[model samples]
Target: MRGGSGHSGRLLGEFRRTPLLVPLSEGDDGGLMTGWQGGVRWIYAFTDEGALARFAQSRGAGAGTGAREWEYLSILGARLVDAVIPTVDGPTGVAVDVADEDASMLFPPVVGIVADAYAVDAGADRADAV
Candidate 1:
C-alpha cells in the first residue's frame, strides 16, 4: 500500500520485510527510493528502462500509459528520496546511487506485493500479473 510522508523508515521496513526490490539514489532533491511490488515497479528520480517496462506491464498499460503513471509516482518518489538518502550510512556520502542493470530486477514475491498495493490504491477490483 501507499504510505504517507515521513514514513520512509516504515516503508523501507515494509519493503525489507516483504523483500521488494528497491533502488536507492541520492540527488539534489534528496534521497530517492523506488521499489516494485507485484507487477508494478516504481522509479523515483532515476529512470531505468527495465524498471519502467515492468511497472507498465503490471499496470496493464502500454508503454505510453506507464509513462503517464510515472508522473504521479514521481511525487511519492520525491518524498522517498528525501527521506532515505540522508539516513544511508556509508562513505558513498549517503547520496549514493544504486542503478545497476542486473540489480534493478525485482524478485517475484516483491513484484506481487507491489502490484497488489497498486491495485488497492488505484481502486482496481483485482490485481493482474504482468
Candidate 2:
C-alpha cells in the first residue's frame, strides 16, 4: 500500500500500474491473463504488493503464498482499459478515474523488487512503499 507517501504521488503519476503478487505463472509476456472469479480474464493487481500479500493472507489455507516465489508485474494501464470488458456478471471495483483519465484502480508493472538479482531501480525500497 503505497499509502499516500510523499513519493507516492510521483509513483501514481508516472507509473499508473499497481503491484500484485501473482504466482509467477499467472501472466505471460504478452500481458494475457486468467483467473479471478468467473474467469474475468482480468489482471488483479494491488496498490502495492503489501496489499496483495495481506489479501493473500486473509484468504488463508492455500491462498497464502507461503514460501512459494511469486513475481510481480506492472501491466500497462491503457492496455487494461482496452481489455477490460464489462458485463453484468463480471467482478466489480474497477471504474474510470475521472480525475486522472485512468482505471480507478491502477498499477504499474514490477520493473524490480527489493532483493531481485537484476537491478530495476523502482526508486524506493519495498518498505517505503507502504
Candidate 3:
C-alpha cells in the first residue's frame, strides 16, 4: 500500500465521504487531517513527511496519539481479501468458469468492507476523543 506521508487531503476527502473511525485532527498545512475509520486510526498526511511529523508531535500526551490511521486501512485490506473469494457455482447453479474471477469476488467484499468500515469508524469516534 502507498504510504500516508503525502496524501492527507485526498485521504481526508476519502474519509469524509465515509464516517471516520476517529476524530479528525487537522494539521497546519490545511490539507492534512488525521482520523479513524473502521476501528482503525489513520494519519491523513496530505503534505510532505516533514509536515505530518510535526503534526503528530503537536498532539501531546495520549496513549495512541501519534498513531497513523492507515494502520486501520491495512486491517480492512485483509478483510477485503476475505470478502473476495470466488464462487464455485454460477447463478444458474451450473458449473462454469469466469474470466474475471478476482473482480467478481471483490464486489461484495468491497461493498461490505466499505459499509463496515464506515460503521466502525463512526462507532469508534463516538466512543473516544480525538
lDDT winner among the candidates? 2
1-130 per-residue lDDT for model 3 (tens digits): 0242455445434333432121233455342133443433333322233333343455542237565542212112323223312221111110011112221111121222345433224345444443
Q: Give the C-alpha miss distance for residue 104 in model 1, angstroms.
A: 5.3
**Per-residue alpha-carbon lDDT of model 2 for 95-117, expressed as tens digits?**
22212323234332223211122
Badly placed stretches (over 4 Å) of model 1 are: 1-47, 64-69, 72-130
Error of 1 at 103 (Å): 3.7
Q: Give each model a TM-score.
A: 0.22, 0.34, 0.19
Candidate 2: worst 10 consecutive residues by lDDT?
110-119
Candidate models: Cα lDDT each: 0.36, 0.38, 0.29
Q: What is the C-alpha RMSD of each candidate to the true structure, in Å?
A: 15.4, 14.9, 19.2
lDDT: the better of candidates 1 and 2 = 2
Q: Could you tell me which 10 consecutive residues in candidate 1 have the lowest summed lDDT? A: 89-98
What is the overall TM-score of model 3 with all chains considered together?
Answer: 0.19
* lDDT accuracy of residue 7 in candidate 3: 55
Reference-based lDDT, residue 69, model 2: 39
Which of the two candidates, 2 or 3, achieves a greater lDDT against the reference?
Answer: 2
How close to the true structure is residue 26 of candidate 3, measured as C-alpha lDDT?
A: 47
Measured on C-alpha atoms, candidate 2 has an lDDT of 0.38
Tens-digit per-residue lDDT, 58-122, candidate 1:
64656663344333233233233344333433211111113443333222212223333322243
